[model samples]
Target: MRQRLAFALGYLRNPRHVGAIAPASRALAQAILAEVLRNDAQVLIEVGAGTGAITRALMPALDRLDRFLVIERDPGFARMLSAHFPELEVLNCCASSVDQLPLDASAPVTLVSSLPLLSMPKAEVQKCVSAMLSLMTHRPGSKLIQYTYAAPHLRPFANIPYGWRWRRVVSIWANLPPATVWSLEQTPRGASIVH
Candidate 1:
């Protein structure tokens, strides 16, 4: 399929970022969006949205008041998403630069990501995760949905910030390499905001 070929090409271009040769399965897409469906959030922001795999699943849930932002660092993938999914407002930028966006703090937001966290350098991974956590603090109760090929038993890195805990864990066997989806929420109290 077109998606499979595009994904393969992207992976070939940058294996560290793309992390997989095939696009996510519809089952994985559906599972990711299901978390958004369960929440009443009106704003959705997706990071590393390669080829709009998850953006397509988010379409039905969008309304006039809703804001869906898809961020991709690759220009080729950004263009593809813009051309194919005209409804999405795709931002061609790195996930680490998300803090620069003029995101509304008061609005409820749901963040879904396909970023290859496990493969990224520890510092880069921490930067992106910290930026997202900063956003969540502004929009209390905001949730972050991320998928990894790693199993649930694989613990988070020791350096990861505290005050964020998993709300749900789903094993998606239908994906190319199989993945586990982690739905996360900030803890009610406080954890020193990491910069």
Candidate 2:
């Protein structure tokens, strides 16, 4: 399809950023969507939404959302996302600036990320990870959904915040190279890594 072709071209341009040769599979998208709908989120923010694969899957959540934001570092992909999803606001910026966004402090947020964190530069990843954690800290009950191509047993972060934890949602064998989804959120007691 045209969408997949565009995604492939984007991947070819920057494999490190695009992170995959093909767009996320429907099964993977469904898995993510299922997690998104598990709880009501006031704000929906997606980072590194390459060619809007997960973005399209997130459309159903729009009806109940207060705001929907798509962050794509690549300008071309940002424009394509904007064009394909005119209903949402697509920002062309690094995920490191996530804390700079004008998000509500009281409203809970759900951040869906497709960024190649492990593949990106260490400094960039640190900045992004710190900012994301800060953003979630400011907005209580906020959760982050991130999928990775790493091993099944690996946690998103080896050491998370003291009160936050990462929960494995599902593993998508259907996807190219496969992927594992993890949700990071504040635990009632303290931080713990659960597989």
Error of 2 at 173 (Å): 0.6
lDDT digits (tens) for residues 155-175 of candidate 1: 333343466666446888879
| Among all candidates shown, the one with the greatest lDDT | 2
Q: What is the lDDT of residue 193 in candidate 2?
A: 41
| Residue 62, candidate 1: C-alpha displacement in angstroms | 0.8
CA-lDDT, candidates in order: 0.80, 0.88
Clash pairs for candidate 2 = none
Off by over 4 Å in 2: 189-195
User: Which window of ten consecutive residues has the lowest lDDT sum in model 1?
Assistant: 152-161
Clashing pairs in 1: none
Root-mean-square deviation of candidate 2: 1.7
